[model samples]
Target chain A: MNEVLTLKNVTKSFHQKTAVDDISFTIGKGEVVAILGPNGAGKTTTISMILGLFKPSAGEVRIFNHLPQEKQVREKIGTMLQEVSVMPGLKVQEILELIRSYYPHPLPMSELISLTGLTGEELKTRAEKLSGGQKRRLSFALALAGNPELIIFDEPTVGMDISSRSRFWQTVDSFAAQGKTIIFSTHYLQEADDVADRILLFKDGTIVADGTPAQIKSQIAKPSVSFIVDPETSLEKLYLHTEIDDIYRKNNRVYVQSSNTDRVLELIFQEKLAVRDIQIERGKLEEVYEELTRGTKEAV
Target chain B: MKIFQMQCKMEIVRVLRNRYFVFWSLVMPILFYYIFTNVVNTNPQDEAAWQAHYLMSMTVFSVMGSSMMTLGIRMVQERLQGWSTFMRITPLSDSVYFAAQMVGQSVIHLFSITIIFIAGALINNIALTAIEWVMSGLWILLGSLPFLAIGTLIGLMKKVETAAGVSNVLYMVLAVSGGLWMPLEIMPKVMQNVAQWLPSYHYGNGVWEIVRGGAPEWKNILLLVTYLVLFMVLSKYIRRKQEVA
Candidate 1:
C-alpha cells in the first residue's frame, strides 16, 4: 500500500494543557479511516495538525513524503473544517471559481455542481445568504474543487439534515471507490460503523483502539442474551457463573452480558427460570465505542 | 499571479457589496462636504482656497474610514468566522493573501478619493491647475499608508465586535483631532499641538500643501513614513503573538 499520511509521535500542546499526546499512525492510499471520539478528545487538534493549521509541539507529520505545510502537500490535500463559513459577499459561483483557481488542476464546474447537489439558483445567491444546508454543500464543493488525492473532513455531518447527510456519505462512498484517501472525525457512530474501513478510537488524547470494525467489536464488545423475565424470578443463580461478564436491565428486560451466550442460555434453562422472548444480541460497534471511550474496564 | 488577481477581485466585490462602505466612504463624505462648505459657510476668507483645503480633508476622511472600518472589520470577521483558517490549508501563501487584501482595499481607497475629489469640483466649482490636482491626489494615495497599517492592526483583534468599536472610536478621534472636519486654526491651542503628532494630520497636511501651490513639506512626509513604520511593526508583533496563542 502506498502511504498517503504518516504521524510519528506527533503531539500538540496549548498553553497549560496537552491536547494530542505522543501518537503515531500511518494511513495508506484509498483507505477511509474514521477518527472517533467524544468532544475534546484531541480529534480536532489532530486534524488541525494534519492540515498544518497548528504545528506539533513534538515529533513530525509527513504527507506524501513532504511536510504538511509544504506547497506540494497542500496541493494534494483538501479539507472541510468543523465551522462552515465562506467569503461573505461573493456569490456561491464566484467564490467557487476563486478557490478553484488556487489549484493547479481543479475539478470541472459541472462535476462539482453534480457531486455537491448545488442548484443553479443556490449558486447565484450570495454565500452568506444561503441556508445552513446550502452552506455545508458549498463547503463540501470547495473541499472537492481541487480534485485532491487526500480529503479530510472534521465533523462533516454535524449540521446536515437527514437527506443531506445521506447524500454526503454517498458522495464520500463514490470518492472512496475512486481510490481517494479520506479521513473524517464524526460523532455519529453509525456513520463510522457503516462507512469506515478502519476505526481509530481515541480517548484522552490517545488511540485506545484501532482496527477493522468487526475486529474492534469482536475484541471488546461482549455478546449478550436478553429475555423478558417474570418480576418475581431471582437472577442471582445466573451471576454465580464466572463466564458472565455483566448483567443489566432496561425496558423491563434483563440482559445477561457474556462472550458465550450458549452457556448463559443453558444456565438459564437449568435454573428453570420463567423467562420468555429470549434473544441474543451480537456485540455492536456502538458498544465497543462506548466501552473504549467511556474508559470502562469491562473489555477483555 | 492569477491566484492573487482572483483573491483581489473577490475582495473588491465583497467590499463593494457592503452597505457600510457605501454609506461611510461615499455618501457621508459627500454630504459632509456639501453641508460644511455650503450650508454652514464658515470659510469667512478666500472661499476657493478653503473649499480646496476642505476637499482634501474630506478626501482623506473618506480614505481613512475605508481603511480602518471596512478593512479592519472585515479582517476580524473573516478570522473569527473561520474563513482565514480555511484559506491557510489551501495552496495560497499567507503573504499572497495579505497582499491581496491590502491591494483590494487600496483599490477601493482610490475609488473613494476620486469620488470625493470629483464631488468637490462640482459642488463648489473649486478648480486647480492640472499639476495641483494630480499631485494632491497622488499624495493622498501615498500618505494613506499609516491609516492602512492602523486598519491592519485593528484586523488583528480577536473579536469582530471589539474591532468595530475600536475602529469607530479611532476613526472619529483621529478625524476630529487632525482637523479633517474643521480647520485647526480656529480650534483651541492644545488641539493644534495634538494635530501635529497624528498621522491623520500629516496625511491631510501633505495634500493641503499640494493644492495650495506648494509641494508637501519634508517634515510631513517624514512623519507619515515614521507612523507607517511604527504601525506596521506593531501589527506584525501582535500577529506573531496571536499565532503563538
Candidate 2:
C-alpha cells in the first residue's frame, strides 16, 4: 500500500486502564478507511496519538513518514475535530480568512464554502447562531480549507439529522473520489458500510475485524436461507417439503433459516411453493459488528 | 519572523478591540502625567519643581503601563480564551510568542506614554536636556522587563478570573510599594523597608533617577535585571507544567 500514515504496535494508557493496547494499523494514500467502534473503545485515543495531541506508551505514529509533532508533517494534514466550529462572534468569511493564513496553499473560500454545503448568505452569518447540522457542515469546511493531503474526522456524525447524515456520507464519497486519504471513525455502521474502502471494527483496545464489508460479511459464519409461504400451507407439509433448519411467521409471511441453501432451494423448486423476496443476508452492519466484537475480543 | 509578525499584528488587532484596555491605554498616562504630577507640586509656579514632579510621575506611569499590567493581565485573558493554544498549533516558537507579546505591548504603551511626556513638559513650561528627554522616553521600554516579568508570572500561574484578580491586587501592591502612586518617603517606615525589597520599586526607582538627570545608579538597575531573569525562568517553568496537565 502507498501509505500516508503508519502506526506500529501502538499502546496508550491513562494510569492503569490501557486506552489503546498493542494496536497496529496503517492508512494508505487515497483510502477511505472507516474506524468503527462503540464509545470509549480507543478510537479517539488512537486519533489523538496520530495528531500528536497525546503520546502513546508502546509504539509510534508516522505521518507522511515523519513523527506527527513535526511541523512539516502537521502542515500536510487537515484536522477537523469534533470540536471544530468556533464561536458565533466569528463571521464565516472572517473565520475562513483567518484559518486560511495558516497554510501554504489552501482551497479558495468560495470552493470550500461550496464543498461544505454552505452558500452565499449562510457564509455571511455568524457560526454560533447556526443549527447543529449547519455547524457540522462548516466544521468540515474549515477542515478542508487548508487543502491538506490527509483528513482525520472523529465521530463525524453523532447528532446529525437524517437528511444531513445522508449528505455527510455523500461528502465523504466525494472526498474519496478526489483521491484524498481519510481516517474517519463512527458508531454509525451504515455510514461506514457506504463509504469505507476498508473498515476496522474496534473492540476493547484492538481491532476485531479488518477488511472490506464483503470480507467481513463472509467472516460471519451463519449465512442462513429463509422462506415465506401462505398461511393455508400446513407447517407440517412445508417442513416435509424442504430441509429448513428453522421456521417462523409474521403477518402470514413464512420465514425459514437453512444451513444448506442449495438443498433448500432445490426443495422449494420441488414443492413449487410461492416464494416472495428472499433476502440472502441481513443488510445491517450493526448486527454483524456486534456478533464479531462480542466476547471474542479482549476489552482493555 | 513573518509568522511572528503575523501573530503580533493579529494579537494587537484583537487587543485594541477591547473597550476597557483601550480606555486605559489613553487614560492612565494623562492621569499620572498631568493631574497626579500637578497635584504633587507644592510649589506649582516654580518651573523647576513642576518639571521634577511631572517627569517623575509620568515615568512611573509609563513603566507600569508598558511592563506589568499590559503584558500580564492581557496574556492571562488570551490564555483563558484559548487563543494562546490556537496560536500554539502554528509553526511559531515559544520564544517567538513571548517576544512578539513584549514588542507589541511596548509598542501600544509607547503611544500613551509619549503623548503624556510631551504634553506634560509643554504644559508645565519646563525644559529637559535633549539626552535626558530621549532617555526618559526610552526608559519606559528599557524598564519594561521587571514588571513584564511580573505580568508573565501572573499569566502563567493564573486562569482567566484568578489571573485578573491576582493582577489587580498585585499591581496595587507594586504601585504602592514602588512609590508610583505615592512617594515612598511618605509611606510608613515598615512599607519603605518592604518597598526596597520589591522589584517594582527598583523598576520605578531606576527610571525616576535617570529622568531627574542624577548620576547613574547601578544597584536598583541591577536588581531590576535580576527580577527580569527570575520571572522569565519562572513563567517558562509554569507554562511548561501547564502544557503537561
Candidate 3:
C-alpha cells in the first residue's frame, strides 16, 4: 500500500511549552487512522501541522511525499476543523460554490449536498442562521468540496447531537468506502474504536499507544464478565478461583476480570448463583487508553 | 482567476445581504451629502463649488467607512473565529485572498462615489463634464487605498470590537482634520500644519484637485502612496506575529 502521509519526529512548540512532542507515524492510503486523546493532548496541534496551519518546531511532515504547505499537496487535502468557521451572511449553496471554485476539479454541488445530507431548505438558509448540527453538516460539505484524497477532521462531531453524530459518521463511512484516506483527532473513544482501522492514543504531546483497536485491547490480556445477581447471593467460594485477576461489585452487578472467561462461567454455573442481565466483553479500547495515558500526565 | 472572481462575488453578496453594512456604506453617506450640501451650505455664489466639495468629502467618508469598518471588521471577526486560518490551509493563496478583499472594497467605493455624484448633480446643481466626473471618481477611489491597508492592518492587530472602535475614531479624525468635513483655512494654524502630515489630507486634497479640473499634485500622490506602503508592511508584520503566536 502507498503511504499517503508521513510524519518524522514532528514537534511543535509555542515558546518554551511543547504542544506536539517529537512523534512520528505513517498512514497508508485508504486507511482510517484516529488520534485519540484527552483535551490538551496535542491532538489539534498535530492536525494543524498536517494541514500546514502551523510550522513544526522540529522534523517534517510530508503528504504525498511533498511538504504539507505545497499547493499541489494541499489541493488533495480537505479539512474540517473543530470550530465551525464558514462565512456568515451567505447561503449554504453560495459558500459551497465558492469553496468548490478553489480546486482544480471539484465535486458537483448536487453530489456534495446530497452526500452531506444537507436538506433543500438548509441550502437556502444563511450559514449564520443554521442550527449547530446543520452548521457541522455544512462544514463537512466544505471539506469534501475538493474531492480530496485525504480528509482530516479535528473533532468533527464535538458538539453534535446523537442523531446528527450518527448521520455524520454515516456520511464519513460512505466517503471512506470510496477509498479516501481519513485521519481525525477526537476525544470520543467510542468513535475512534468504531470507525478507525488504527488508533493512536496520544498523551502529553506524544503517542502512548498505536495499534488496531483489537491489538490495543489485547494488550490488557483480560476479558470482563458482569452480571446482576441477588444482593444477598454472593458467597465466599467465588474468590478461590486463581483464573480470575480481579473481582469487584458495583451496585447489584458483580464483575469478574479474567483471561479465562470459560472457567469463570463454569464457576458461576456450578455455584447455582442466580444471575440476570449477563454481559461478557473482551478488554475494551477505552480501558486500554486510560491505562496507558493515565500515568504520563505528571511526567511532562 | 476564477477563484478570485468567486471570492469577490461571495463578498459582494455578503455585503448586500447585510443591512447594517448597506446602511453605513450607502444610505448614511447619501443622507449626509444631502444635509451638508443642501441644508448647511445654501450660498448662491459658491453653491456649486460647495456642493462639489462636500460631494467628494462624503464620498471619501463613505469609502473610508466601508473599507475600514466593513472589510476590516469582517477580517478581524474571521480571524477570531478561525475562518482566516481555515482559508490559509486551502489552495487559495494569500495574495488572491487580499486581492479579493481589495476588489470588494473597490466595488463599494465605486458605488458610494457614483451615488454622491448623482446627488451632487440633482440636489446642488453641481455641473461637471463626463471627463471631470469620471476622473474625480477614479481619484477618490484610488485615494482610499491607504485606508484599505489601514483597515486590514488594524484587523490583523486587534479584536473585532477594538478594530471597530479604532477605525471609527480614525475615520472621524481623518475626516475632520483632512478638511473632508470643513476647510482647513477655517481651522487654527497649528491644526492646518498637523493636517499637512495626515495622509487623509493629501488624499482629500488630491480628490479636490481633480474636482477643480486640475491634476493631483505629485507630492499629494507620493504621500498617499507612502501611507499605503507603510500600512501594507505593517499588516504583513502583524500577520507574521500572529502566525508565530
Candidate 4:
C-alpha cells in the first residue's frame, strides 16, 4: 500500500492541556478514514496538525514522505475547515478563480461548479451576500478547485441542509472513486458508518478504538440482559462466568453485558437471585460508541 | 507571476466593492476638501498655494482612511473569521499574499490621489507645472508606506471591534495632530511642535514642498522611511508574540 499520510507518535499541547496525545496513524492512498470524537476530543487539533496549521508539540507528521508544511505537500492537499468563511466582498466565482490560481494545474471552473453544485446565480453573488448554505457550497468549491490528491474536511457538513449534505457526500463519493485519499472529522456516527472505510474513535486526546465500522461494532457491541433486582440481592455469583463482559446497575435494574446472555440469564436463576422484569438488548453501533467514549464503568 | 496578478486583481475588486471604503476614502475626503477650502475659509493670501497645500492634505486624509479603516479592519475581520487560517493551508505563500495587498493598496491610493488632484484643479484652478503634479502625487503615494504599516500592525489585533475602535481614534488623532485637517500655522504652539514629529505631517510636508517649486526635505524623506521601518518591525514583533501566545 502507498502511504499518503503518516503521523508518528504526534502530540499537541496548549498551555498545560494536551490536545492530541501520542497518536500515530498512517493512511494509504485511496483510503477514506473518519476521525470520530465528542466535543473537545482533539479531532480538530489533529486535523490542523495534518494540514500544518498548528505545529505538533512532539513527534512528526508527513505527507507523501515530506513535512506537512512543504510546498509539495501543500500543492497536493485541499481542505475545508469547520468554519464556513469566505472573502467578504468578492463574488463566489471570483473567490474560486483566486484560489485556483494558487495551484499549478487546477480543476476547470465548470468541473468545480458541477462538483460543488453551485448555481449560476450563486456564482455571481458576493460572498458577504451569500446565505449560510450558499457559503458552504462556495467553500466546497474552493476545496475542490485545487484538484488535490488528498482532501481533508473538518466537520464539512456542519451547517448544510439535508439536500446539501447529501450532495456534498455525493461529491466525496466521486472523488473517492477517483482514488483520492480523504480524511474527515464528524459528529454524525451514521455518516462515518456509511462513508468511511475505517474509523478512528478518539476519547480524551487518545484514540481508544481504531478499526473497520463492522469490527468496531462487533468488538464492543455485546448483547446484554437486564432485569430489576432487589436491593439486598447480591449478584456476586454472576461474576464467576467469563462469558459475561460487564455488569452495572442503573436505577433498580441490573444490566448483565455479555455475548452469551442465555448463560447470564441461567446463572441468575441458578443463583436464586430475586429478579424480575427481564429484558434483552441487541448490540448496536451507537451503544458501542457510547460505551467506549463515556468511559464510565459502574461495577456492581 | 500570474497568481500574484490574480490575487492583486481580486484585492482591488474586494476594496472597490466595499461601500465603507468608497464613502470614507474617496467621498468624505473630497467633501472635506471642498468644505474646508471654499465654504469655511473663502479668502487666503496666495490662494493657489493654499489650495495646492490643502489638496495634499485631503489626499493624505483619503489614503490614510483606506489604509487604517478599510485595510486594517478587513484584515482583522478576516483573521477573526478564520479566512487567514484557510489561506495558510493553501499553496499561496505569505510573501505573495503580503505583496499582493501592498500593490493593490498602492493602486487604490494612486486612484484617490488622481481624483482629488483633479477635483482641486477644477474647483480652484490650483495650477502647478505638470512635473509638480506628478512629483507631488508620487511623494504622496510612496510616503503612505508608514500608514500602511500601521494598518498591518492594527491587523494583529484579536477582535474586529477593538481594531476598528483603535484605528478610528488613531486616524482622527493623526489627521488632526499632523495638520491634515487644518494647517499647523493656524494651530497652537504645542500642536505645531507636535506636528513636527508625526509621520502624517511629514507625508504632507513632502508634497507641500513639491507644490511650492522645491524638492522634499531630506529630513521628511528620512523620517517617513524610518517610521515605515519602525511600524513594520513592530508589527512583525507583535505577530511573532501572537503566534507564541
How far residue A39's Cα lies from its native spot in candidate 1, in Å, is 1.5
> Residue pairs in steric clash, candidate 3?
none
User: TM-score of chain A for each candidate?
Assistant: 0.93, 0.80, 0.83, 0.90
Candidate 4 per-residue lDDT, tens place, A1-300, comes to 999999999999998778889999999999999999787888999999999989999999999999988888889999999998899999899999999999988999999998899999999998989998998898888888999999999999998999999999999999999999999999789999999999999888889999999999888898999999888888888888888889999877899999988888888888888899999988888888887778532211
lDDT sort, best first: 1, 4, 3, 2
Question: Which RMSD values do the candidates have, in order?
Answer: 2.6, 5.5, 3.4, 3.0
- Poorest 10 consecutive residues by lDDT, candidate 1 chain A: A291-300
lDDT of 3 by residue, A130-209 (tens): 98889889999999999999999999998888888888889888889999999999988999999999999999999988
Q: Which segments of candidate 2 are over 4 A away from where they belong?
A: A85-99, A116-142, A157-173, A221-283, A290-300, B28-89, B92-95, B115-130, B240-245
- Which residue segments of model 3 deviate by more than 4 Å? A224-258, A261-281, A295-300, B41-45
Best by lDDT: 1
How many angstroms is residue B102 displaced in model 4 relative to the true structure, after the best TM-score fit?
0.3
Off by over 4 Å in 1: A230-242, A295-300
DockQ score, prediction 3: 0.76
- Chain A only: give the TM-score of model 2: 0.80
Candidate 1 per-residue lDDT over residues A219-271, each given as its tens digit: 89899999999889899998899999999999999999999999999999999
Name the weakest run of 10 consecutive residues (lDDT summed) in model 4 chain A.
A291-300
Tens digits of per-residue lDDT for model 2, A1-300: 788999999999887888888988888899999889877788888888888878888899998899888878766777666654453345677667766676778889877876777877778787667777777787777778788888888888877788877877777678778989998888888878888879989888788889997777766544455556665666565576445656676555555556566766676667776776665544346667876666644444
Lowest lDDT block of 10, candidate 1 chain B? B40-49
Residue A170's lDDT within candidate 4 is 91
- Cα lDDT tens digits, model 4, B163-198, are 999999999999999999888898999999998999
- When sorted by DockQ, best at the front, the candidate numbers are 4, 1, 3, 2
Error of 4 at B228 (Å): 1.0
